[model samples]
Structure formats: C-alpha cells, structure tokens
Target: MEFGEILRLSFAAIRGNKLRSLLTLLGIVIGVFSIIGVMTAVQVLQNGIESGLSNLGAHTFQIQKFPVMASQAEWLKARNRKNIDLRQAEYVASRMTHALYVGIESFDNGETVQALSGEKTNPNVTVFGENPEGISTNNWTIAEGRTITAADDRSGNRVVVLGKDVVSKVFPRGGAIGQEVKVDGVRFTVIGIFEPKGAALGGPNNNFVAIPLSTFMAYFGGNRRSLNIMIKAKGPEYYDDAVEEARFLLRTVRKVDPGKEDDFSIFSNDSMIATFNDFTKYVKLGVGFISFISLLAAGVGIMNIMLVSVTERIKEIGVRKAVGARKANILSQFLVEAIVLCQIGGVIGIFVGILAGNLAAMALELPPVFPYDWAALAVLICSIIGVIFGVYPAWKAANLDPIESLRYE
Candidate 1:
C-alpha cells in the first residue's frame, strides 16, 4: 500500500479508539510541559539581568570588603578582613595614574529622614557619603540644580543630592533644591536631584540621598569602616592595566604578604554576570533531569498502549497481510500512529508551557519570553520516543503469520 493509505488507516484506528489515544497522550503532555515551563521562566530572568544589571556602563569595577556573591565560609573569611577605609581609598586614587576617575563612597542604610517644612514627614531613607568624583564614576546625571563640587568636599558642607523618590516625598512643593532635609536628626541642604535609574537586583536605585564625604564623616562619623571604591578606566583598551595597577596598589597599601591571598575583593560588572549565568546553568541541568524522568515514564506508557493495539487488531493485521500488504508497510503504519500521538501531545504542551511561564515571569516583574529552541527540541524528542517505544509492537504485528492470526481470532 502507499504511505498515504497507511497513514489514513492509522488515523482511522486512532479515531476508533478515541479514549485510549487521549489517555496515551496525557503522559507525553505532562513530560514536555514540566521541562518547557521551567526553561522559559529561567530564560526570562536571565534576559532581565543582562539588560538591567549586567554591565555598569563599560570598563568600570568596584573594590569592596566582600564579594558580590559568596558562600558562608568565604563570608566569614571576608568578615575577618580589615574594612576598605576612606583613607585607603584616597591613597589608591592618588597612586592610580591610568584611571580617569576614582570615587569612594560609604553607605548607612535604614536611616530616618524628615523634611522639616511643616508637619509632613517621610521616613526610612538610605544615605551615601561620596566625594566629587562619585558623580562621574556612578554615571549619575543631575536632573536639577548642581552636583556636589570639590569645594563642598573640602569645606565639609552640609549639602545633599536627592534621588527621585526622596525628592518627590520630601520636597512635595516642586522646589527641592535649596531646601533642608533632616537626615538622622542632622539637617542638610539639597543641592541637586538625580535622574531616575529604575530598579536593580540590590533594590530600588532611586531611593537614596547623596552627600559630601566630609559632611557625612562629620555628622555620621568617620570611625565607621567599610568603604566602597569605584574606578573607571581611562578607556576600554586600558581596562585590564587599570585593574592590575589598582590591585597592586591596594595590596601594597594593605601590606599583604606576596605569597598570601589578598584580603580584598575586586570585581567588574562582567564578573557578576558570569556568576549569575553559572548559577542558572545548574538550574537548567536540574530541570532537564526532572523532564527526563517524566519522559521515560511517558515512553513506557506509549509502549504498553501500542502492544494492546496490536492484540486488538490481530484479525485485521491477518487480512492486510493476506491481501498483499508488506511487513514493512504494517510496521510503518503502527510507527506513524505512535509518532502522530506524541506530536499532538508535544504541541499542546508547548502552548501551555509558554502561557504558564509568561504568567510566572509577569508575577516576578520580568519580561515575557518564548523558548523556540526548546519547543523544537521537544517535538524532535517526542518523535524519537515514539520510535523507541513503538518498535516492539510494530515488529510483533508484522511477524505474525496470517494463517495463525486468522485461526486465533
């Protein structure tokens, strides 16, 4: 018989056993759905991190007391290390000739801030103590008024730059500049407003106040350790040299033994991104393992159903063989039926997975994603599963003697 005739006969058999066909499809559907859903969600989060938090412009890195992502053992070791103080930051800045800008900042979180105009008050604001070069290093654009100047740092002036969130709440009257806001009971004049930078992996970027390092040290006290140094290379070509020089200078300043590991951590935006990708790579592997287990179960189900199908159509198989239907034709018919069933399940699973995954992404505030490559792979895997499971049943149907099959039923 022709291939088209065999395919039509396979469809007729499936339609004749509608309930059984649907039951067989259920296993494959669930297997594909489990894997595709997880992959789609992970892809969406990766895309978001790459676009929003990955690269801090270009050729920029930070020197901090602790690594961005560390284990408990590493954290304990880092905690024992001496803090990156402002004095050390200044020393490194002065020695680094290849750097275009070097800025130092210290942060105090969960401080209460109140604008003392009338009775209106807002609380819980983050405060940053930074030098003049911090504006350029952080890539912050002044939305209104002027940025902190070198004179402000030298004189220890009580001037501040308000972030978008702080400006809206503290200075609701439209004019935030020249106004005084009390930060932890210390009053400081607002010198500028920063442009909105949106949310980051850490938290909201536009929800803090920036002040001169000298004034912050005086009010918040300079005794606190833990300073973050931001450095921007002169150009992309000099990025490696700048980082090497910074590391050498810092090690020298900290008086580290040449053989011993440096106590400080230095990392760029690219390093952070690579760390995140490494973490997600494990997640993908885990998901794949789980999907494999499900698919294995589904393959067993397909085999069982195909075996029963051969038994039920024993007399029909005998008639086909007696009427000149070749064994290869008989095998091909059964195989096509199994493949068609799996493809049906795969298509449904892909659709459901995409919808479910996008919904989860929306809940997490990430953009929607469609995993096309995974979908194509799903279809291909389903076809392979069908062949593996259908082979035994198809062979059994093809090898049965026509006279014996006719006599049995």
Candidate 2:
C-alpha cells in the first residue's frame, strides 16, 4: 500500500472521532503545562536571585550570627549562639592580614525622620547606622558629597546619607546636600546622597537613611555590638584562604572546641547558591515524577481508544484485506495515526506550556526563562509513548481474519 493511502486513512479516523481524540490529548496537555510552567518560573527566579547575589561582589563575604539564607528555625538557633560583637569585628580586622577592608554594621529599629527646610517636612523614611567601610562593603556608591569618614565614626558625628528616593521625597529639588535633617529630634547634617542601587534580596534600596554607627547606637537605643561583619579579600585568589582563616579565627574567638561545630555561620554568595540548588533538586524531581504520571495516563487513554477503533473497524479491515491490502499496510496505517495524534498533542502542549510559564513569571515580577531542555525531553517522552502504546492495537487490526471479519455485522 502507498504511504499516501495510509496517511489518509489515519487522519480520516481521527477526524471522525474528533471529541474522543481531543479528550485523550487533554491529559497530555495538562501534564506538560504543569511541569513546564512550574520549572520555567523556578528557573527564572533562581537566575534572578543568583544575578542579584553576584552584584554583591565575589571578593566579599560576611561573618554573622546566622546564615544569610537559612530557614527561620535555623536562623533563630544561630542567633541564640554567642553574639559576635563590635570588639570581635575589630579584633578580626586587626588579626587578618589578607583582607583589604573589614566593616562592622549594626542596625536599629525604624526611626521617624522629619526633614524641615522652611516647613517642607517629609516624614517617611527608615534610618540606618553605617560608616565608611559600610559604604564599600554594602556595594553602595555615593551620588553627591562624600561617605562618612572613619573620623565621623570615631567622633560619633551626626552626619547622614540619604538614598535616592529619600532625597527625592524630602528635598524634591536636590537641595538635600549639606542640609540638616532630624531623626527623633537629633539633627544630622546630610553629607551625601546614595546613587540608586536597585532592589536587593531584602527590599528597595532607595528608602533608607544612613548615619554613623556610633550615632545610631548612642541615640537610637540599639545593642552597641555589631551583629554582622563584612570582609573583602585583598584579591580573588585569596578569597578561599581568607574565609578559612576567618572561620578559624571566629572559632577560636568564640571558644568552640576542636571536636564541636562552630557556633557562628560564615556565608557568601556561593554558599547561598549551593543551598538554594540543593533545595530545588528535590522539587524538580517531584515535578518530573508527577508529569510522568499524567503523561502515562494520557498514553493509556490513547491505547484504549485505538483498541476501540480496531474493534469497530473490523469489517472495514476485512474489506480492505479482501481487496488485497497486506497486513503490514494495515498495521503501519494505524500506528502512524496514533503517532500523529500524539505529535499534534505534544506540539499544542509545548506552545501553551511556554506561554503560561512566561505569563506567570511576568505576573510574579520575575525574569522570563524558557524551559528549552525540559521541553525537548517532554517531546521525546511523548513520541516514545506513541510508539509504545500504538503497537498492540496495530497488531490486533493486522491479524484480523478476512472471512470471519467481513461476515460480522
């Protein structure tokens, strides 16, 4: 039999039972959509987070009471351990010879600020306490005026730096530089304005006001000790050694026995990424298993429909055999029909899946990413399903007895 004849018969069968074919394909479509859309969103979020972390500088790492990216319970447990105070930060700075800059940062609760420039009072800002090293440590750049000096930190000077949004909201006309703004009635001269550093893993960067750490600790009633210390290695090659040395120093300082785990957490961008990747591995595996189940069900449905088709078309098959059509021809035609149905379903599913995933990413305010590799795998699995499920029904139709089949009603 000619290939054209086989294709025509296969498509005719599909066209005749349009609703059943569509229902069978629905399972495959939903399964593929769920898997593809979820993974795409996950991949996009992962990339965005990694890129954000990368902007924090690979040469820098932080020593803190807790891991920066752990769950709440773990974070709380770490916090309950020995607090690494300002003295410890100073000690680490004094001891480490490989670090170029070591910074101590401590934050207090939100304080209200009233910007009074001839009754132009703006009162919505979160104030922080930082020093010269904090500027370089937090990847902040000054837009106007200079960052707070070590002299400012040492003398507990009441100088403040404004973020871009705070400057806009308070000054409006760029008149904030060298102006005095009062935080809880303690006046601070605005010595600088920070350049816009887009949102980080925490929140928008433009809504903060920074002052000297000494001033914040004295007037704002915070624990005078530092909760986090940041260290920048002198060079890229020295980063690993710096981290190891810092860990050893911290362990010795905290008095952790050699046989016991360290009391504090040392974290960097690499550590955070490793933690996130470990978490996502299990999630992706579960999604893969779920999608496979749905695809299997769809395949089974296709097989059942193909079997019904063979039973209903027995007389037609017998008539074709009586007219000298070979069993191979009959088998090939049915198998091709099943595969074509699945290929069409797979195509539709892939298109919808990609569209849904991208739309979801936009809705969630994350980057859009295509699951190209996973899509390819899904298509390959669909094709395999077609071949596996179509074989038995195709064989059943091919072996029909012409004499008995033709006489059946």
Candidate 3:
C-alpha cells in the first residue's frame, strides 16, 4: 500500500474516536510539559543571575560571612561562625598589598524611606553602609553630586546615596543631590545618585540607598551584625594574587587555626554563577526523574489505547486482509496512528511549557529564553515512545484471523 493510504487510514481511525484519542494525548502532553516547563524556568533564572553577576566589576570578589547560596546544614554551621566585623574587614583591607581597593559594606533591608518633601518608598528598599571605595568595587557610577568620602566613614555622617529607583520615588522633580531623606526615620542628606542598574535575578536592583559604613553600624549594628569586604585587583593579572593576599590577611587577623578551614566565604562573579548552577543541578535531577516516570506512564497509556483501537477495528482489519491488504500495511497503519497522536501531543506540550516559563521571565523583567535543545530532545523522545508502545498493538492487528474476524457479531 502507498504511504499516503496508510496515513489516511491512520488519521481516519483517530478521528473515529475523538474523545479517546484526546484523553490519550493528554498523558503525553502532561509528561512533556512537566519537564519542559520546569527546565525552561530554571534557564531563565540562570540567565538573569549570570547577567547580574557580570556587573560586579572586573577582577573583583567579595569576602562574606557566609556563602551566597548554601544548604540548611551549611547555613546552620555558618551561623555559629564568628561574625566578620568592621575592624576585621579593615584589617584585611590594610594588609592586602596586591589589592587596588578594598570596600567595607553591610546592609539593612525592608526599610521604608521617606523624602522630607513627603514622597516615600516601600518597605522593601535595601540600605547599604559602604565606604567610598565601594563605588569602584561594586561598580557603581555616580550620576550626580559626589560619593562617600573617607571622612564620611570616620565621622559616621548621616549622608546617603540614592539608587535610581529611590531617586525617582523621592525626588521626582529631579534635584535629588542634596535632598534630605529619612531612612527608617533617621535623617540623611542625599550625597549622590547612582547610575541605574536594571533588575537582577528576577528582582528589583535599583531600589536601594547607600550610607557610610560607620553610620550604618551606629544604627543597625548589633552582636549579629556582619560585614562583607569587596576587593578589586589593580589588573586582571593581579586578581588571583590579590584574592590570595586577602585570604591570608583575613586568616591571620581572625587567628584561624592553621589546620582549620577559613570561617568566611570568598567569591567572584564566576563563583556566584557556579554556586547557583550547583543549586539548580538538584532541581534538574528531581524534575528529570519525575518526567521520566511520567513519560513511562504516558507510554503505557498509549499502548493501552492502541490495543483497544486494534480490538475495536478487528472486523475492518479482517475485511482489509481478505481484500489482499498485506500484514505489513496493517502493522504500519496502527503504528503511524500512535505516532501521529504522540507528535501532536508533544507539539502542544512544548508550546504550553514555553509560554508558561516565559510568563515568569516577563514578570521578572528578564529576557525570555528558548531552550531549543530540550525541545528537540522532546520531539525525539516522543517518536521513540510511539514506536516502543505502539509495536505490540500493531502486531496483534496484523495477525488477526481474517475468516474468524469476518464472522464476528
């Protein structure tokens, strides 16, 4: 028989039982959707994070009290470690010969900031206490006025640098440079405005205020307050040596035992990306396993549906056999029908999954990601599932006894 004839018969059989075919198709769609949706979302978040991390000035890294991303057990252990204070950070900063600049910073978050003129920001605004050197270390460019000076840090002056979002909210008419804004009810005169940095890791990046580290400790410091030290190397060639010098300086200042591990974490943009990737590995593994099981179950559903289709069409199969239709043609027809159903389901599943994942991207203000590799894999997997599950029913239909089938009630 011609391939066109076989295809026509296959489509006709599927059309004959619309409800059943649709129900069977759903299994495949669900299986594919689960895998594609989760992976696509993961990739989008990963892209956003990488983009954000890249903005951390070249040849720079931060020394913090704990890992940016850590498991519960790791966090618990880190919580017990001694906090790295302003004194300790400064000690490391002073002795690091390879470092070009070292920045001391700490933060308080979720503070409602109010402008003296009556405008205000939401409680989610992040307030950072950073030294003047942080302007370079953190890759912040001044858009207006002047940045924090060494005197600001030493005197604990109530000066603030506003991010673009904060500037827009408080000084909508544009003179933000010297405006007095209340940060969590404390009066701080705006000293500068920072260039806008877009959303990062699917969250707002420009909704922040920077104040001198000394003033920050005066208000927000407690027994648990810790400092993060950002260091920038003079050049790319000096980066590793600078980081090593900083590490040794910290170890010596903190008096860490020679045999013990360092209490703090040192990380750069590359390391941050690596840490995030490690976290996503578990997510991928778990979702991949669930998808595998779901696909197997979906394959079983396909087989069951095909078997029923073969049984219902026994008389028709007999008529075709008696009219000299070959067994190969009968087998091909059933197999093709099953494949067509799976392909349709797979296509629909891919479309829905991509749409669902990109919706999250849109909300995060990040660019959408199309995982072409996964889509191609889904198509291949669907074809394999069709062949694996459709073979038995096709064989059964092809082997029917024409004379007995013809006499069926």
Candidate 4:
C-alpha cells in the first residue's frame, strides 16, 4: 500500500471510532495539563524571587543574633536570647578590619504616627531608625534631600526621612522637605524623601520613616542593643574573607569558645537563596508525584484503547493480507495512528496548560514565564508513550493468520 493510502486508512479507522478515540485522548489531555501548568507557574515565581534577591546589593551580608532565613520557631528562640545591642555592633566594627562600612540598625514595624498639618493629620505610617550607612547597605536612594549624616546620628537629632508613601499622605502638595511629622508625640523635621523602593519579598518598602540611630534608641529604647548589623565587604573578591572576619569578630564578642558553635548568625545573599531553594524543593516533589500519577493513568488508557482498535480491525487486517498487503504496512499504519493521536492531544494540552498557568500567575501578582524545555519534554513523553503502549496491539494484529481471521469473522 502507498504511504498516502496507509494514512487515509488510519484516519478512516479513527473516524469509525470517534467516541473511543476521544475517550483515550481525554486521559492524555488531563495528564499533560497537570504537569505543564504547575511547571510554568513555578518558573515564573522563581524568576521573581531571583530578581528581588539580586536587588539586595552585592558584596554585602548581615550578622545578627538570628539567621536571615529562619522559621518561626527559630525566630522565637533567637528573640528570647540576649539582644545583640549597639555595644556588640561597635565591638565587631572595632575588631573587624576587612569590611568597608558597618552599620547598626534596629527597627519596629507597624508604629502608628500622626502627620499634622493644621488639624488635618493622618495616623497610618511605619517608622524606622538607622545610621547614615543604611543608605548603601539597603541600596536606598534619596529623591529630594540628603540622607542622615554622622553628626545627625550622634546627636540623636529628631530628624526624619520620609518614604514616598509618607510624603504623599502627609504632604500631598509635594514639598515635604523641612516639614515636621510627629511620631509617637515627638516632632521630627523631614530631612529627606526616599524614592519608592516598591515591594520586596519582605513587604512594602515605601511606607516607613527613617530616623537617626541615636534618636531611635532614645525615643524607642529596646535594651540600647543592636537588632541587626549590616556590613559591606570591601569588594566582591573579598566577600568571603569579610564574612569570615565578621564571624570571628562576632564570636569573640559573644565570648563563644573556639570549639563551640558561634552564638550569632552570619547570613549572605547566597545563604538566603539556598534557604529558599530548600523550601521549594518539597513543593517541586509534590508536583512531580501528581504528574506521575496522571501520566500513568493516561498510559493505561492509551494501551486499552489500542487493544480494542486491534480487535475491531481483525477482519479488515485479514482482508488486506488476502489482497497482498504486507505485515509491515499494517504495523506502520497502526503505530503512526496511535502516535498522531497522542501528539495532537499533547499539543492541545500544553497550550491550554500554559494559558491557565499564566492566568494563575497574574492573579498571584507574579510575572509570566514560558517553559519551552518543559513543553518539549511533554511532547517527547507523549510520543514515547504512544510507541511503548501501541506495540503489543500492533504486533498481534500484524501476526494474525489471514485464512483463520477471514473465515472466523
């Protein structure tokens, strides 16, 4: 038989059993959809996280009483320990010579405020307290005025820097510099306005106030110790060396023995990424298991449908053989038909899955990502399943005795 005739015969056979063919394809559609959709969504989220992490700046790390990426239980335990106050921060700075800038900052979230403008004051803002060095450490940029100076920090000056949101809420007319905004009843002159930093994985960065470290300690005293210390490595090449120096210095300050684990935690950007990756590994595993289950069911459905097709076409096979049709021709026709069915279903499923994944990502406020490699793998898997499951039925039909098949049916 010609190749054209073989293809025509295959389509005719499929057309003869439309309901059965659709039922077989349905399993494949569901299986491909489940895996492809999840993978696309994961890809997008991973990209967003990496972008946020990169924004943390280069050659910088933090040393604190607590780890940067700890669970709630670990955080609670760390909070209960002795605070790593400003004294410890000073000690680390005095001892460590590798770092370029060592900044100490302690902050309280959700601090309510009263922004007064002749009785039209607002009361929804967050306040932060940090030294001059916070500018480089947090990669914050000044939009209108100067950042807090060293003299400002030392004098405990009641000066404040307004975030973009604070400026809009308190000074809607746009000239907020040198204006006064009250925080917990203490007045502060707005020294600068920070450009919007947008939202980070931690939360919104444009809803807070930044005051001098001394002013913060005096106004909102919490053991006069440091809540967190940010250190900038001298250069990218010396980041590891700086971390080691900081660690050694902190251990010495904490009076930790050389043989014992360090009491304080040192966290770098790489460590943060590793922590996030570990957390996502379990989610990936769950997705893989569910996809596996669906694929297995689809494979079984494909095999069962192929066997039925073989049985229904027994008489046709005998007739073709009587007319000198080769066994190889019969085998090729059935094999190609099975593969085409699966490939079609897989193509449709992949497109639909990607659409669904992108929609879900948008709803979650994440960027959309297309996983070309995953889609290609899905297509390859469908083709492989077709060949593996279609073989038994094709072989049986090809080997049937023409005389017996024709006589019996």
Candidate 5:
C-alpha cells in the first residue's frame, strides 16, 4: 500500500477509537505544556531583567558600601566598614582625570513629605541627597522646571526635585515648581520634576524626592550614613582607566592597608546583568528537570496505549500479513499512528502553554513573549517520544505469525 493509504488507515483507526486516543493524547499534551509554559515565562522575565533593570548608562558604574550580590558573611563584614562620605566622593571627583562625571548620593529613610499647602501628603517617600552631577550620572531627565544646580549644592539651598509619582500625589493641582514642600519637617522649594521611569527590580524608580547633598547632610546628619558615588567615563574606551583611578583615590582617601581588601564595592551595568543571568540559570535547570519528568511519564503512557492497540487489532494485522503486507509496512503504519497522536497533542500543548505563559507575564507587568525555539523543541521532543515508545509495540505486531493471530481471535 502507498504511504498515503497507510496514513488514511491510521487516521481511520484513531477515529474509530476516539475516546481512547484522546485519553492517550492527554498525557503528551500535559507533558509538552509543562515544558513550554515554564520556558516561555522564564524567557519573558529574563528579557525584562536585561532591558529594564540594567538602567545604568554606558560606561557608568557606582561605588557603594555594600556589594550588589553578597553572602551573609560579606554583608556582615561590609556593615562594619566605614560609610563612603560626601567628602571622599568630592575628593575622587576632583582628582580623577579620566572621569567625565561624578555624582554623590545619600538616602534619608522613613521620611514623610507634605506640601506646605496642606492639600496632600505621602506617608513614606524616599528622599535622596545628591550633587548637581547626579542628574547626568544617573541618566535622569528633567521633565519640568530646572534640575539641581552647582549653586544649589554649593550654597546648601533647600531645593528639591520631585519624581513623577511624588508630583502627582503632592501637587495634584499642578504648578509644582517653586512650591514649598516639607521633608521630615524641613521646608524645601521644588525646583524640578523628573520624567516617569516606571518600576524596576529595585522597585518604583520614580517615587522619590531629590535634594542637594549639602542640604541633606545639614539636615539629616551625614555621619554614619553611607554615600553612593556614581561615576561615568568620558567614553567606553576610558571606562577601565576611570574605574582604576576612582578606586585608587577612594582607597587612598579611606587609608586602606596595602594587603587588605578595599572596603567599598564597585559594580557596573554589565556586572549586574551577569549576576542576574547566573541566578536565572539555576531556575531554568530546575524547570527543565520537572518538564523532562512529565515528558517521561507521557512517553510511558504512549507505550502502554500502543501495546493495547496492537492487541485490539490482532485480527486486522493477521489479514494484512496474509494479503502480502511486509513486516516493515506493518511496523511503519503503527509507528506513524503513534507519531500522529503525539503531534496532535504537541500542537495543542504549544498553544495552551503560550497562552498560559503570556498570562503570567501580564500579571507580572512584563511584555508578552513568544518562545518560537521552545515551541519547535516541544514538537521535536514529542516526535522522539512517539518513536521511542511506539517501536516496541510496532515490532511485536509485525513479528506475530499470521496463522496464530488469526486463530487467536
């Protein structure tokens, strides 16, 4: 018989036993779904991390008291180290010849801010004390009004820049510029408003108020509080030199011993991205293991169902063999049927998995992604499973003697 005729026969047999075929296909569907769904979700999250979380501009890095990824022991050691201060930041900024910009920043935690107008208030607002260069180093753009200037930091002026969220909340009536707002009881005039930055891995990026470093130190007491130093190189070519210069300056200013490790941590956008990828690698491995187990179970189910199918069609196999059907032909026909069943299941699973994965992405506020490679892999795995499981049953049917098969039924 032609290949087309054999395929038609296989479809006829499946259609004849609709319920049984469906039950067998369910296992394969679930198996494929598990793998594809997990992979899709992982890809989407990874994409978000690479694009959204790595916000540091080109050739830029930050020096802080703590490491971005640290063990408990490292954290404890870092906690005991002296805080990076505004004076040290300024020294490094003034001395580093290869640097294009240096920004000094400190945070005042647990602060409540309210407009003097008394119309609105935020119970918990982050307050940042930063120098004038912070705007460029942090890659923030001013949406309305002017940013903190050299005059503001030098004169210790009580001026502030509002994040989009803070602006919307405290200045609902608009005209936030030149308005006075109380930060933890100290009054500050709004000089600028920042553009919306949305949320990142570290949380809402635009829900804070920025003030001059000098003013923050005056009011919040800079002692014992760690300052973050942001530095940007003139270009990518000078990034290494800039980092080395800043490190040397910081170590010298802090009076670190020659043999001992530096107390500060310096990290760039590339390091942050590498760390994130390393963490997600393990997540992918765990998910892949689970999906593999499911597929293995589905393969077993296919083998069991194919064996039953061979038994049920024993008389039909005998008649075909008696009519000059070769053992190879019989084997191929049964194999094709098994593969077709798995393919059907694979298609359904891919569709469901993509849908479920995108739904999860939506819940997390991540962009939807279609994992085409994973979908193709799912289909390929399904085909492989079908062949591995189908071979045994197909061989058994082909090797059976026509006379015995005919006599049995």
Candidate 6:
C-alpha cells in the first residue's frame, strides 16, 4: 500500500472509534500538559528573578542580621541574632579598607506617604532609611533634583527621595521636588525622584520612599535597630576582598569569638541567584517526577487502546491481507494510527500548556515565553510513547493468519 493510503486508513480507523480515541487522547493530554505547563512557568520566573536580583548594583553586597534568602523556620534563629546597629556599622565602615563605600540602611513596609496637599499613597509603600551611600547602593538614579547628600544623613535631616510610584500617588503634579510628603505621620522634604525601576519578583520596584538612615531610625524604629550595611568594591576583582574585609571588620567590631560563626549574614547578587536556583531545583524535580508518572500512565492507556483497535478490526485486517497486503504494510498502518493519536493529543496539550503557563507571567508582569525547546521535547516524547506502546499491537495484528481472522467474529 502507498504511504498516503496507510495514513488515510489510520486516520479513518481513529475517526471510526471517536469516543475510545478521545479517552486515550485524554491521558496523553494530561501528561504532556502537566510537563509543559509547569516547565514554562518555572522558566518565566527564572528569567524574572535573575533580572530582579540585579537591583543590587555590580560589585555590591550587603551584610545584615538576616540571610538574604531564608525560610520561616529559620526566622526565629535569625531574629535572635544581635542587632547590627548604626554604631557598629559605622565602626566597621571606618576600618574596612577594601570597600569603596559602606552604607547603612533599614526599611519598614506597609506605610502610607502623603503629600502636603493631602494626596496620599496606598498603605503598601515601603519606606527605606538609607545613608547617602545606601541610596547609591540601591541603584536609585536621580531623575530630578538630587539624592540625599551626606549632609542630610549626618544630622538626621528629614530629606526624602521619592520612587516613581510614590511621586505618582503623592505628587501627581509636575513638581515633586521641594514638596513635603509625610511618611507614617513624619514630614520629609522631597529632594529628588528616582527613575522608575519597573516591577520585580516581589512587586513594584518603584513603590517605596527613601529618607536619610538617621531619619528613618528616629521616626520608625530607633538607632539601635538592626541595619543592613551595604558595601561596594572598587571593581569586580575586589568584590570578594571587600566582602571578606567587611566580614572581618564586622566580626571584630561585634566581638564575635573566633571559633563561633559571625552573627551577621553577607550575600551578593551572585550568591542570591545561586540560592534562588537551589530553591527552583527542588521545584523542577518534584514537577518532573509527577509528570513522569502521568506520562507513564498515559503510555499504558495508548497501548491498551491500540490493542483494542486491533481486536475490533480483525475482519478488516484479514480482508486486507487476503487482498495481497504485506505484513509490513499492516504493521505500518496500525503504527501510524497510534502515532496520529498521540500527536493529536500532543498538539492540544502544547497549545493549552503555553496559554496556562503564560497566565502566571501575566500576573507577575513578566514577558511571555514560547518554550520552544520544551514544545519540541513534548513532540518527541509523544512520538516515542507511540512507538514504544504501539509496537506489540501492530506486530500481533500483522502476524494473524488471514483465514483464521476472517473466520473469527
């Protein structure tokens, strides 16, 4: 038989048993959808996180009382560590030789900011208490006027730098600089507005307000609260050296015993990315295991359905063989039928999976991903499942005696 004749017969066979074929297709669809949907979403998050981690400027890292990435289970231990106060941070900064700039900062979230005109922002605004150096460490660029100067930080002056979100909400008018905005009932003179940083993994990057570190502590907490000491190296080559220098200085100043671990945690952008990757590894593994089981079950369903097809078509096979059809031709026809079934399911799964996966990206404001590699892999896997499960059924139909099959019901 010609290849076209075989394909036509294969599709005709599937169409003949629409309900059964659909049941088999359902298994394949579920398996492939599980794999593709989860993988595509994960890929999107990975891209967003890597970009978001870049919020920390190059050659910069932070030493804080808490780890950059930690679970709630470890929160109690982290909370128990002694606070890295401004006094201690200053002492370390005065001695750390490798760091070009050492800045101190702390923040409180879920506070409201209001303009003098009574225009107010949502209660979700994050207010950062930052030194002048800390402002630079945050990668905040001045779009208008100027950032808080060292003078503003020295005397706990209530000067502020507004993120784009704050400015939009509090000072919607053109003039934001020189306006006074109240942060948690404390008034601060807005000295500058930082260019919008867009959204990050956690949320909007430009939805915060920054005041001098001293002002933040004076009003929000106190000078004794834990501070994140931001450190910048002169270049990438000095990055490690700067961290080590800061660590040593902090330990010496904090009087941490030599044999005991330092109370502080230090992390850079590279380390943060590595931590995030480690977290995602388990997610992928769990997802892969689940998908594997689903696909395995789907493969079994394909084999069962193909065998049923062979049984129901006994007389047809007998007639074809009697009409001089070769065993190879019979085998090829049944095999094509099985393959067509899987491919149909695979195509549907891929389409639905992409749509479902990108829904998460839409929520996070991340760009959609095509996941070409995964789509191709899904297709290849479908073909493999078809071949692995269809072989026995096709071979059995091919080996049947023409006379016996014709005599049977």
Worst 10 residues of 5 by lDDT: 197-206
Residue-wise C-alpha lDDT for candidate 6, range 1-409, written one tens digit per residue:
6889988987898899899999998988988898889889998998798778777889899889988789986767888899998889999888878777888889888999998899998899998898888877877789998988888988989988889888888877769888887889988888898988857898558999888888888899866578899998988899888888888888988899999987889988889888988988898789878877888789899999999889988999999999998899999998988889998889899889999999989998899988999899989999998898899999999999999999879
lDDT string for model 4 (179-267, tens) is 77788788989889997874555454487888988899889875655567788888888888888888888777778778977677777
lDDT of model 1 at position 97: 82
* TM-scores vs. true structure, each candidate: 0.86, 0.83, 0.82, 0.85, 0.87, 0.88
Candidate 3, 66-116: lDDT as tens digits: 887788998889988889987789898888888888998888889888998
lDDT (Cα) of model 3: 0.88
Q: How many angstroms is residue 302 displaced in model 5 relative to the true structure, after the best TM-score fit?
A: 0.9
**Model 2 lDDT tens row, 1-409:** 7888888887888999999888887877877777887787678767766766753565899888777777888887876787787666677877987787777777654555557764333455667777578768778789989898999999999999988877777787777888888776889899999988745444544777888888877887646444677888989999989988888887877788999987888878888888888888888899889988988898898899999989999999999999998899889988988887787788788788888878866765666788889889878887788888998999999999999889978
lDDT of 4 at 43: 73
Q: Report RMSD (Å) for each prediction in the order shown.
A: 3.2, 3.6, 3.7, 3.3, 2.9, 2.8
The better candidate by lDDT, 5 or 6, is 6
Ranked by lDDT, top first: 3, 6, 5, 1, 2, 4
> What is the Cα-based lDDT of residue 120 in candidate 1?
30
Per-model clash counts, in order, read: 0, 0, 0, 4, 0, 0
Give the TM-score comparing model 1 with the true structure, all chains together.
0.86
lDDT of candidates 1 onward, in order:
0.85, 0.80, 0.88, 0.79, 0.87, 0.87
Between candidates 1 and 2, the TM-score winner: 1
lDDT: the better of candidates 2 and 6? 6
After superposition, the stretches of candidate 6 with alpha carbons farther than 4 Å from their true spots are: 1-9, 97-100, 318-325, 402-409
Steric clash pairs (candidate 1): none
Clashing pairs in 3: none
Better of 3 and 4 by lDDT: 3
TM-score of candidate 4 versus the correct structure, residues matched by position: 0.85
Candidate 6's TM-score reads: 0.88
Model 2's TM-score against the true structure: 0.83
